[model samples]
Target: MTLASGLTLTVVLALVSVVALVMRPRGTSTVDFYLAGQRVGVATNAWAICGDYFSAASFLGVAAAVYATGLDGAWYAVGFAAGFVPVLLFVAAPLRRFGEFSIPDFLGRRLGSERVRLVAVGVVQLVILSYLVPQTVGSGITWELLVGQGVAGLSPYATGIVVSTAVVAALVSFGGMRGTTWTQAVQFLLLLGALLWLAATVIGEGFHYGDAVEQISTAPLGNPAPDGGLATEPNALHPGEPAVFGEPGARYDVLGQIALMVTLAMGTAGLPHVMNRYFTSPTGSAARTTTVWVLCLAGVFYAVAVMLGTAAREIVPGAVADNPWLDELTVDGVLTVPEHALPVLGRIYGGDAGLGVVAAGALIAVLSTIAGLLLAAAASWGHDVYERHLNPRATQRQAVRAGRITTLVTAGTAAGIGLVLRPEAFAASTPSIVATMVTWAFAVAGSALTPVFLLSIWWRRTTAAGAVAGMTTGVVVVIAMLTAGTVADGSPWPDLLLAPTLLAAPLTTVVTVVVSRSTAPPPDVERSWLIMHGTAADRHTQALARLVLAESRRRRREVRRARR
Candidate 1:
């Protein structure tokens, strides 16, 4: 049925996010619009970060990957969650300490380099766009399956992308950070709830996880071995399953797996939208705390997704085709669209309303992520470009106006890209398409920008030139890979997990250090350190207030001593 029951749940989620936007206090200041006046608390900000980070990939892709492969797909979740560990240890607190609206702001002011800011801005925009389009496409694919209406000269896929993008843009434009944060926190909880609920119901249905694994192990995963060898379907439940493991593809090696993990983990620090949330925290310490919380939240959610993927394989064999939307999207009985697995299972277990809820949650996931990315784009353009470059004399109101304009423009640009390369079905399934784009972004950010940011904050020797060189090398390598047909379908090595990042990131760091050693460092590197690492004024004020109270107690003791 159109607007499947599970989709109804999704509608409620979207409505709730919208209500949050409408009910939030109108923002009047730049700080409020950009960083929610920097007043977000630790727990709330952490949850919001989870909402932003989860995205379509975590919610849909993780489960789909597991369902497609066996245990190997679980690596996606592990890699994604592990990225936060580095963020907490090296990046989060220092990032907030700088008190910038976006990553470019921090780098620009820290190095007093306008060129650095511009380059950073360009990279940030590229990464954000790359990340944003797939999400829009994912939303469209989901809507097509759930709603089935080709409205306004658009297919269901296109309609989903437009509607979802518009909703997020509206929320970000009107509600700003305050409303967006609250909605995202709530949405994350709902997403977790949906995942946990599905897991519980699946387990309760008496599906044995171990038994399922053994059952799967019996088959030739995705394909069989030919002539009783690995060439033909080896076993029905084992590696013969081409739909899951690329039955017709090559197996990845250990080095490749390590590279994939490194790419994802290091790349966390470079994601523009996720980094933007740091500005919302009250202090660096709070941002660190938020990362810790996010780690826990991500751990639980990912584990559940892995379990659900296994269950989907065992419980509903050929269930992909039974669902109305799945029939259109799947290739034969197998899912061409791995992203649809979890949502399809939701319908199978919960009926129409269950499907609606899961679908809506998926939509909400995209909406929240898009809103965050759009805001990051706005902050980068408005603060870094219009204010810093074009109109240094502009007032706060003017800056806010610039920000709004940029938000609209960035959102439109992202939507345009999503439309131009939009896939007919399972766009994400293509080896060099959605997944490749995402990996390229990760490679760029991790290889170039992340190392510089970490060294800038931690190592005293990192020069401004070093930072620029590193970022440049990283971006150039990743871009070249993307354009060079490195990841084209049926390519031998492109599908390897670390084929891009593992090779490119080290080159970026080497270039950075080499260039840095040859050039004189910034004159006020010490002063920049103070600015980036120093405690916030408000935090110091509170400390002084506490000290004064302690002094008063000491004075009373002295007076008592004198009198006695």
Candidate 2:
């Protein structure tokens, strides 16, 4: 790592911290602290939502996966972008219209049961921590590349986690949702700008995307793996021979491919952080618009990430002899870890300064994700558990205080977990370790929360008891399946156990519907539907009414001033 790169990362993080603090919400209400006072606009919220979704998985992991697996990795980008379609078509409007503080809050109130809230809280926390750990781990990995040393004799990885976790925790505590929203929006743009810059530079160097794909796929997908690195097997995409980058089965079988796509696509509907962002929208229609914008912005971002990965496959090996850094990371022109794919490109293309910019982008992605996760955790605990159940008479100030405390605790716990789950612990065998962990979270969310959530909105027969049973069934079944898979890591049934969402989600839906049939429905289904399915004209007219009220208030103030 170069001093120039280290300084750039430090300066950039400091700026983000300052800006978020400046945007910190003044009101101490639950809405102010947790959902940005429900006042965020479409464009800004859309960008923030993109930043929340991207994580280190999209910014770093996707590229590395593509570099390592050829065409198989492109599916990850597709799965991620496609996930939002379900959110837009099914969940976004109703969720925003029936706005609550968090997922647990929504579920609890929708079902009129504190028990449902408590159960949902547990699942939400599980998902958040599952999501948070990977972001924290990604921070350490990026730091290891950007700055090789640790502060005060700590390991490079540990130092990275501690510093990043501390800074992000502080920001979440100080700024709340309002601060996080602004910071995330800015972070996403910066990340996009970095990708665009690198893409432009590569294209100017006469790099052809098609040529790179053909060249890499022409043989089997291969990269430099030093003595300490994990060994590559025969290409899965190709089966018996070296796999081409354009072929299927490069990394997974046909079933595995379908499973992966289902896990990721349905995952968005249940992600606590992403759904919470919708609650910040001014109206349901605004939330729908925001989802549309997210799809557009995210498409451009992931497309560039995929291209960078392909280009890096060709760029890095040739630079090995010329760049000393390559010697440290590569063996026989192959990268030690696929995660090094993007950062190494930055150094080759623009030296330390370029490497610094990309590294900072990686860190920014991690930070933005951690912020969203921490806030989601806070909302789950403070609004759903504490305010609603523990302290029914609590003031807004008290509620905000509880949320701030929870955010700190959640952030710290995730950092500690991240420190324990070091890459070395995993033997650095999988370069895309962060993505793998994130996929677990997605699987859990899609299975446990999403199916039940959609049912509650669209099927009025969904009862509190059915929701509880369905959610519990989903969580328990998916966890059991994932655990079984982990134990049988090298076994033949790997793909099925590894990504059980395709089975888990359908099972959850079945269990929910069956239980609902036996349980009593809510007495006021039409009332809930009326609130959720309000038309665009209704939304527009409501907005006009609010505007009129504000104008009349302003006129009255002016008349009072004239009389004085």
Report lDDT (CA) for all predictions: 0.74, 0.86
The best candidate by TM-score is 2
* Lowest lDDT 10-residue stretch of candidate 1: 224-233
The list of candidate 2 runs beyond 4 A from truth reads: 223-232, 235-239, 424-431, 536-564
Our tally of clashes for model 2 stands at 5
- Angstrom error at residue 543, model 2: 15
Evaluated at residue 273, the lDDT of candidate 2 is 96
Error of 2 at 295 (Å): 0.1
Candidate 2 versus the native: TM-score?
Answer: 0.93
How many residue pairs clash in each candidate at the backbone level?
A: 47, 5
lDDT, model 2, position 331 = 65
Distance from true location, Cα of 177 in model 1, Å: 1.1
Tens digit per residue, CA lDDT, model 2, 1-564: 577897889888888888798999998888889988899999999999988999999988899878777778888889989999999999999999998988888888888788889999999999999999989988998899889889998888888899988899989989999999999999999988888999999999989999888777666555444445434545554567765566766677788789989999988899999999999999888999999999999899999999998898888878887898788777667766667778888889889999999889898999999999989998998888888889999999888889889989998889889988765444233437777788889999999999999999998899898999999999998899888877765776566677789999999999999998998977767667667886777756767887999999999999999999
